[model samples]
Target: MSQQQTTLHVELGDRRYPIYVGASLLSASNLIAGAIKGRQVVVVTNETIAPLYLDTVLRQLPDTMLVTSVILPDGEQYKTWQTLGDLFDQVLAARHNRSTTFIALGGGVVGDITGFAAACYQRGVDFIQIPTTLLAQVDSSVGGKTAVNHPLGKNMIGAFYQPTAVVIDTSTLATLGEREYAAGLAEVVKYGLIYDPEFHRWICANRDLLAARDVDTLRHAIQRSCEIKAEVVAADERESGLRAILNLGHTFGHAIETHMGYGSWLHGEAVAAGMVMAVRLSAMRGSVDVDLVVELEQLLVDLGLPVWAPQDMTSATFIDLMALDKKVIDGQMRFVLLNALGSAVVVDDVTEAELTALIDG
Candidate 1:
């Protein structure tokens, strides 16, 4: 963008891509054009975001580019095999080829589904991440972690497909409702908690500015989160080792999502609550301090994020679903627990007895 932007590059071998974060990124067509390897475009969005941001994004594409649009139903409940399969059906019917570029034009669900479709289509095709929500900008869009939920587990079926480029328009946050904005902030808070204590403290200090979508504060938050995520994804793109640490609160969070049913709670809301549970669990194990748990909870509370699982879910159900989580390997459940703020460890050594107490409490 001629507006003079600070560009971030994700170096992933031959699949390297650039992430541009600034104002009017979608309206800036050359930046978008620079990312795509070929001309054909398949813009996948949903009913909710279509009327709002789709056209503005499409306006950026050149008249020579053939753009096909697909707007699916809105909500996480629809992030399924059936939902994702529709993109394949639509694209394949149109005879989309290896050169076809899929553009994810909504929030996480759209990004995950579109990226997964990109991974599988023609044995793999190029896709762009145009993450509209704050959560997507900070977490989903940058990383290549793509997936569709299974009735049995969250992200049970998916692929790791990097985007050709990620275009994040900070302006979109204005339309996000308070609850939805808060949900996205949960991920932002996560980046701070898991990796950068300095960023965590910055978030704490700038809570008001962030809540108000102050550009300078928001830009810093988004950029730092992407930097942390890009480094992790580079080291362990498939999440075999170091990358799993990114799932700090996800193990418990995914369980709540499964038992409650998807979309009932926004993913970030569930993660915020889940992180609180993990901290509490860690403290009860006699390792983590109680004060840290409370402080973390307070930060989330300040952001208007949920700090507890839904009252409707039975602990027994929560446990059962967690057992089936993708993190479970070698007949043991692996959890990413904090050693302290801004650092985490994936421990598989916690006993069944200890786990039961954590969930029961």
Candidate 2:
């Protein structure tokens, strides 16, 4: 049975777009085809996903449309300028023009790189996100925060380009690897923590259902997560202030991804540990109770996520790498810390001593 589809919109004034969340949406030809502004479409995917759902998506487009598939190797390690340049090579070789619509057919890596390509291709073009992974569906694919990673930082080189639409097929989670699916849950937990305490509590109580990949449970989780993100993005499309709160654990998480090497620690795993750190720091500053740290750590553990930073990475290592984070402004470190569950604040007054104590302790 197909799950009921819920449609939400990211109201970006002139650029508002709809997000469709449900089961078997990849087969929704109308949803996919309607979003393309032109007859030219570029389906960008990776090896792993291409074998799984690429052909299925291709079958949706009408035979008359100019369709090209740019299949790249899969992995977070591959999100680089070198790979991006190569992607451009493929599109240009196909003679794709400004009318081309780039379709991202995999997880966050594919979505980020493909969106960046669309953003730069002919100065700008349309793109649709068919996020297969739970992580991409819940977080990365929704907000239009597109980018390729840099050696110095994660998402350092990117744009605030929105997708024409998002088609999330919940059934794809059935094919997702255990770790990847769990990593996605970290983002789900984040929504509850930073924006909705009741949602967080629901996630905790329903961990078993989520772990088992219950369709209805997963659908609710994805829809609610996207709704929160959409609300945040609509208010601050450029991350000027409010939207930055959406990056609850990203600063520390990005450092972990950079230091441990991209793909070594999945973005969501790093964020799990990073959230613990952020909450711990909040406790240190008396913004939130120290028990909130323990509560979050236990929840992550229950959700099969890492609750603490890697043992090999010292506090100094985190400090050094985090200094390079995109959130840093004018040499001041800003952290999104929770004053209470469901209430988050961005603070730049964190002293070095506080960081050392949080990480080293």
Candidate 3:
């Protein structure tokens, strides 16, 4: 039998595009070629991903279009200005012009840096996201917030540029390492925790199936996640207001990434630990019940995600690092905390004393 397919649209008016979700989408030449705006195409992917799926993607492009490939070293640590510069060198060496369309063909790191490259290249160019990992398919690939990480904070330098299309081939997940696959679940759980209480319950009930990578379950999770994220982006493309809630565990998570050094912990693993901290802080602030904290932590643990912050880091260190977060405004650190199981809010009123106590405990 043939596999199913799903499509969602990001309503950005003139900048709107479609997100195609299905199995074997990499084989769909028409879907990929139709999204390209020009005859010149550059595919930017990481070393780990290149050997696995690059040729398949290349096969999908129209023969008439000129194509070039840049294979970057795979890792969160490589999401830097230097690596981005390397990508630019390849584009320039190939003589790719402003009309070139760049294709990001890896996970979140590749998607972010590639999209950022497209945004800055010749003032701006078109790009498509062909995200392989579940994390990228559901979260990073849908949102146009692209950036390279800084030593001080994650995603400190970037742009709010949307993509021409997001092609998600679920079959690619089969190539993901177990740890990476589990890491992606952190973002999946985030959607449930922040906006869909029922989805949270669904995740809890289907934990085993999801961990096993059941196709139907994986498809539903990815589809729903894209739907929720697309809706949020449509309402606030630049994260001016409502979109901030999407940063649920990111403040703490970004701190962990910076302090631990990027790549030490997978983005989703750091986010899993960070979500626990956010929930605990919410409880301390009297916004949520302690039981809710335990529940969320249990869920993360069951999913093979870490629920504790790194033991080596002190509370003060976390506070200092978090001050560098992109969400900080006017010297106040903004946090996205849950007030209930499914509702999240962004607030900058978290006092140092409260944060210190929570981190210390």
TM-score of each: 0.96, 0.98, 0.98
lDDT of 2 by residue, 1-361 (tens): 3559999999999899999998888875478988887999999999999989998999889899999999999999899999999999999999999999999999999999999999999999999999999999999999889998887788889898999999999989999998999999999999999999999999989999999999999999999999999999999999999999988998899888898999899999999998888888888888888888888888889889998888888878988998888899989989999998899999999887888788777
Sort every candidate by TM-score, greatest first.
2, 3, 1
Local accuracy of candidate 1 as per-residue lDDT tens digits, 1-361: 4264668888899989889888777776477777777889999999989999888878877888878899989989889999888778888887778898999999999999999999999899999999999989999998798999988888889988899899888878888889889988988888877788899999999998988889888888898889999998999988889999888789888988877889888889989998887778778766678998888888898889999887766566766787888889977888888787788788888776676676665
Q: Residue 49 lDDT in model 2? A: 96
Give lDDT per model, in order: 0.86, 0.92, 0.91
Candidate 3 accuracy as lDDT: 0.91
Q: After superposing candidate 1, which stretches have Cα over 4 Å from the reference?
A: 1-4, 312-315
Candidate 2 overall lDDT versus native: 0.92
**TM-score of candidate 3 on Cα atoms, chains taken together:** 0.98
**Model 1 per-residue lDDT at 315:** 63
Over 1-361, each residue of candidate 3 has an lDDT whose tens digit, in order, gives 1268888999999999999999889985478888987999999998999999999989888889889999999898899999999889889999999999999999999999999999999999999999999899989999899999877678889999999999999999998998899999999999998999999999999999999999999999999999999999999999999899899889999888888888999999989999999999989888889998898888888889999989987789888888878889989999999998889999889888887798876
Error of 1 at 110 (Å): 0.5
Off by over 4 Å in 2: none
Which residue pairs collide, candidate 3?
Answer: none
